[model samples]
Target: MIAPPSPVPDSKISLWTPFTFSLFRAIWIASLVSNIGTWMQNVAGVWLVTILTTSTLLVALMQTATSLPSFLLSVPAGALADLTDRRRMLLFTQGFMACMATLLGTLTLMGNISALGVLSFTFLLGMGAALNGPVWQTITPELIPRPVLPFALTLNGVSINVARAVGPAIGGVIISYFSPGYVFLLNGVSFLGTWIVIYSWKRKVAVSSVPAENFIGALRAGVRYVQYSPAIYAILIRAFSFSFGASAMWALLSIVVARRLQLDSSAYGVMLSWLGAGAVSGAFTTGIINRRFTVNQRVLIAIVIFTGTNLSLAFFPAAYWLYPVMFLSGMAWLMIMTSFNTTVQLNLPKWVQARVLSIYMLVFQGGMALGSVTWGTLADHFSLWIALVAAAVWLLLSAFLAIPFPISPAENLNLTPAEHWPEPTVQGDIDPDDGPVVVMVEYMVKVADIPAFRQAVDQLVRLRLRDGALRAGVFTDVTNPSRITEFFYVATWGEHQRQHHRFTKEDLAIETRVIHFHTGSVPPRVTHYIAFPKAPNVDIAPPFENMEGQS
Candidate 1:
């Protein structure tokens, strides 16, 4: 039978709009299986560690084992994602995780696994996840149209929550009847579905004739972009603070199930499923939330609700009370996470998308890693109830961070590369690898417009730095006040070329506003300069000879 047609874009788009595309649908379905297996593995891994050691620190360390890799490797992985074939990267990461899970299972089933062994294998699995995170995040926009991106992200969250609702309970059953080893084995096997789907489908790579950036350069560029982007860094700060505070639930919930509630693994899984159920419910109502609340408002509301969930964990301790509380926690998590993630995705340009995303993942996962250890330590020394209470208090306090670093909307600005810049003219052929390139734009501004021009130039400085400029400056002519020259330095000729292509419509708009201050009958005069190394009788080989062979 023929498959149903994909959803058409119109007013009031449905969350399932992304599912209409065959590839997104297939990947989404496969992700459900993989996520289910992952959640199952999580339940098993934590349960295995908890069973092996009665130490609350060791139990909490399970989360640390899983999260720390993402904390360390996300930025490099993100750079790799942007620099390489994302589909192949996804395949490799999936296969790697499968192997790690299978080996962990084999060892566990043989009764050779120790607490250290479980944490070690979980760390290996986390490495695979770290490598996978950014590439997977970057691919969705390519798979579907832009208008449906928000829905796609929401559905992706739904997929995880759906798996969350079911996976842990099933994992608990497997753990109760079979063993944690079986859960690991099942998780390993689950990755094959996604691998197979990815292998069968073809992915189109964007063609670029410009020399590809070195890994170090890419990392630096990524950092520079985020360094100057207030909107992005604001999100990063908010995300880190939220993750740091919210991680208490993830780190200590299993312990609470065992000690506080006096429940078996199955009941622990059930509690988690309630959390997932709440998230799933929250995912459906996001459209309503979007319409009624601002991004900051939504985030604040979620944080408040999540604080209540933490208080519930500390004070209630009963399963019945936790059922709805867990649900609320899940909803809160979905709101906060989805808000941060979706905002980043919407604001990014494709060139540095994965790299910035990697930084985002780094901050996000780093917060969780550090927070897990912190809360765990608190639990071990003081009490689990105390840890939960402190986390609740911290979460409430973190809400105040939103006031100074509120997230901005990106719907007004177009981020697509405009390619508006024409190739620069040169008197002779120049080496792409030749010394630092300096670009200067000279404009004649009226005395009155100098103040306004300087205001616009301030914005232009950030745009230059965000694109690739190492240093940017504005100089006024000593003799003629109207002669204002703006200059920026880039590392190399090739990098400068890449910077030309990196300008998005938003950036061009900023440039346009800056140029509006120029009162010259003609447009601003632009010039390029490349540095030459000073040497005495040095046999200077043509730079192009070496640069030609370089990638």
Candidate 2:
């Protein structure tokens, strides 16, 4: 017999706990090398655009090209990740990006690269990243236990920032001595490590009785989940708002270094490194931040720091002062991003994990894409300072949004699948496609408890709608004043079955509370009905017309 799993550790767990898992450690190291190469390419690509054109719009367009695919494709990609074998999907995307990076390098070396060509290649790479993102995010749970997931995400941030700290600086040195072609080539080669790691791993496949969801249906389910989840949508709003305002620095940093500070590409790389270094520092402190403050408070602090960084770029524009400010900016980015990521991850169950994450990717990247163009246009028409100042002001205003959409912590939630719903009894082998399925639960509530019952059932209504109910309602019997019934409709027999798997301990608790108000002699009665079948060749007579007492 298999040994029982170890008990989960406490809240004060070390930040490095995830590294104890060898698979996680191996994957993390491989991903680090790949991320470094990607960062190097990012530095080279952005600087190359500056060399090709003086137009601020063209330069900012580079950032847009990188973000736009994710904005457009993340939802579909999420659905695909959930529906397909994620390991294979990740392998394909990594290989695709490696080839694209190689081709870009070759083109640059041939002296045939243009502004549009660079942007086009960047867009292709962005598509690969877009496809890779959701699968990559969802894989952490497989690598380590849930208790360590938050820190694992923090460590993921560390990998990116450590690469950020090291990559741009190294890319700068390479560019100073050689051509960007070499940097691109190195990036192409870097994917080998991660590609090999993923290929070597043996992934466990889960066996389930429920059939896999179709693409369109999976997409709809994900969208529906987000529609009713207030905590999640609040996180999305904050993510979009933060990225929208703060993207100015990323979109225009090259121009700021070249035009305002009169610094070389090497200095530009150094500035980015400082930002990365600060982020690396911040990653270690996230555990402390989590212990010390709420998610909303952490995000608020990050916004304040980021606003300061933008204001410094707008007003100071001095190299001496900016080194530290950029460092602070990195820390701010790490704090807020990890907080959003961790909260979202903790709140999701295994089934919908990738799909919802893809939605998060859509909002986060969508915000950056739109914001880049907005800030770039402002810079092109007016001045860089005006753009920076405007962005800083907007970021400051984003802090107030927290008041209305405060983040709810996921620490207390029990997201493990409840699987408590009993199998619905049926007379025949019901086709999964048969629908629409109607579910009714009869409850006996006395007049004295109707108000309390209604209030509790109201919460139940949201729970039903959130987990796949197409429509739901509460009704009272006209002849029997004390008899009340709650009804809901699912789109298909299969969907109703899937909904059985969607409930968590938290959801069951809400439902249990609603059930507590029932005054019936027996437990609430549940009944299921399917839509009447139509026979094309035969005429059907109504059963009620043949009743014995019928007139």
Candidate 3:
């Protein structure tokens, strides 16, 4: 046996490529102006409500109005991104937002603004945000290649944190010297710069042609894809849980510092800056700390660290300690979020990358919306510290609870197939007589177990085929040296149902070799079918055996 020397990787193949940096710069600049405006509006709006209304409910409700759109609109928006040109769609949304911002600025400047007007505008902004949020995430993969995709996403977080730090600080001063009305005006103007830059890009993003009429059908496909993929589902769950549990501070942080810590609004802004600073640092550190970790591993670690660090803030006693706590919280959160972004971009096929990412944005942001309302209510009733503490606990609890769904490789059911596995009939619009139904399910398996698991998983696939069940099954994306996703290809409703209903000693035998070598990973969430158009008509009955009834 000959021992082979390890080959050295090319240094020129560095993660920070020119294209990524350019796109990053453009997006960063755009986000910078927009984010500052966003933060300014956020701070001023919440403060205005707290000052004018005695009820904390009103203050919390104001926060609710801002983020609720994400919950309602993220997934559908993602499907739209897939169906249409994401860049053009973003332009429209940005215009909507700019108009809304300008309107609010005009009314505020004229001294004609009422609380109801503010609330109404808040909903309008939410509407724009909901439309924008999902598509925004999907755009990243189109901007960068696969290897440097992580770096690009990390760069994004770094940029956002920079804005988070600076925006509030500047907004505080502006609001102090001028008025919250001016923040709206500044934000409105900022949109034009981004719009111009995007419009001016020499090369336009090119994607496959999608028909205008297939909008509803495309949406159903994306949703069906999500439902069938356990890895994707787990990713969404991890994201949603992480966002829902950890977002408590987003709403209450200002109130906590201003009311509880007895700090001025400027000081509160400074503290937020510190948090953003931590987040930026965290993003940079991930590039170094994460040597060869898979995206899922990094995501899991980030969530744990972010949740843990934020919890520390709740227990800290001194006001001076607040800075350190907020900073660490930001840092850890940056790691988790950047990891999540990179994972989604890397795993999804270019064809539907934006669409899946958009769904991700919806679930997570919607979680944020609910978290704001829930934590805000809790903070109003209980002590701010108690609310923060509870949020941390929920975050911690969620990590463990969410681990079982095959989000990462560390959990049980660690097995990966050599090829894409077949799933049941998932695509609703397509009939059984059409083509095969495809569903990708990610799983983690030990490196040693992969060979045996391949056979084991194959047996499972063949069982469905013999029963006249699964049409096709293959491995799609392997998470690392250890984990892989088995994409199932089953055709029709009968085969789909049959695969789930019957498993005997014969079916169990193949798993033995697979399990012997297996460490463990999460089991794939079986999906019936993913919606893709093929069978347009259903009236012509083949009088095929009732596979559905028998299965």
Candidate 4:
């Protein structure tokens, strides 16, 4: 069994402890500034669309344009993050967004901007954000020690919410007193801080014996890993459900303030600020909540609270009531999102973290994009109240999903690399890009242990596939009733080598269980075979004699 991580001193485990690390602190501060600018830009963009068009669909479409890129590009971006230099990728994406924001601000100031123009720029900015997200997340582990990683994640959330709390009110004030163009321009300038911080970071490059996978290979491997991981799938499902329902308020808040509450831009900003305030409160308290509740319980409570808030927002017309309701909504938002993110992180090994996270990002954003349009169309056709009520109903139903797909904490799982697999014995030189490689592991099992052995090997098949096996199965010897051979295929010798690196301590435990069932005198005997084309007349021969080994 894998041992638990060493205990962090209680004094260093508090909410603010992540700031003790210099790099994390620097990056956090810079990111906070950038996130504030982003929130400001969001406020300006949404408000601008509302002003330029009377169509609720068009206004909602603004959110769709921004979120759609995350759905389309997150997986590829995640693959890139895993396969390339993450810091440099972040710098490029940030710079690209800054340019997009600047161009948007310029056009708006020059009186050359239209609804379509705003959406085009918003889409471009979204693309940059999508590309930057996985890289940014992957870098966090490099910045802070494991003892404080959870706190660092929470701190990241807090920074965003803190920006949300401040940016909207400030953006609203600027829009009211000066112009929306100024808010956009400020956002454009804000990216410079993040760029500088990323550039200044002297990040250490990881040295690996094997080269990184090609883009397509990385993408496929990531997908395969997630497919076999039930924990990740559950998290994705919950995230999508929550995001779909929660998107209503986010996508239509400006319109809701304008049409339902009869409020000005400044008032709308205050509403958003209150929501952010609730989020901040939730972030600060998450550590305590996590200690008290299970993952499933936390998610359930958050959903119920958020649903109530949505229903209240739908029925209550008073402006003052929105403040308390939105505050509650913010709290629920934090609880749900933080739980989902932490659960996913805990379950994943470093090898596939970014790729799986990208999938999570895709589902979350895709749900929001689709939900925005649905709610907007409902609002346009019927009323805002009906739209919100419908969304609230859906959220209420989503709470039941947790029953079948319960969220489990990953503390018990040993995800650290085991590095226990012995290197394959090779008799001759083999190209790294050689043809498909087949491996056979022979086990001598008594008749009484065959059923148990089969079950154990079945589990091994999944692990093998998750770690890059192309195909896997078990076979019985025709002449020897007690001989069982477990076999698997990999596209290349290089992939089989990579699989050795992917094995975790938990996987090692499983391997131990399988080995106990083997009744062989020594251990399971392993053999490797590489396929080659048949010559015109000559028979291809096996490379080595006694081609047997052990793992």
For all candidates in order, the CA lDDT equals 0.88, 0.88, 0.65, 0.84
Candidate 1: give the clashing pairs. none
Pairs with backbone N, CA or C atoms under 3 Å apart (clashes), candidate 4: none
The backbone clash count of each candidate, in order, is 0, 0, 31, 0
lDDT digits (tens) for residues 10-57 of candidate 3: 354343552334655677678777876787777766665665568767
- The better-scoring model by lDDT among 2 and 3 is 2
Off by over 4 Å in 2: 1-8, 43-64, 103-121, 172-182, 252-266, 380-383, 534-539, 542-551
Estimate, for each residue in 445-480, the C-alpha lDDT of model 4 and write its tens digit. Answer: 999999998889899989998899989999999999
lDDT of 3 at 367: 85
Whichever of 1 and 3 has more TM-score, that candidate is 1
TM-score on alpha carbons, each prediction: 0.88, 0.89, 0.69, 0.88
Off by over 4 Å in 3: 1-23, 44-59, 202-213, 248-267, 292-300, 307-311, 369-390, 401-403, 406-551
Cα deviation of 406 in candidate 3 (Å)?
Answer: 4.3
lDDT of 4 at 430: 71
lDDT string for model 2 (148-179, tens) is 77788999999988887788778988999999
Off by over 4 Å in 1: 1-8, 44-64, 103-120, 175-182, 254-267, 317-319, 378-389, 534-551
Alpha-carbon RMSD, each predicted model: 5.7, 3.9, 11.0, 5.9
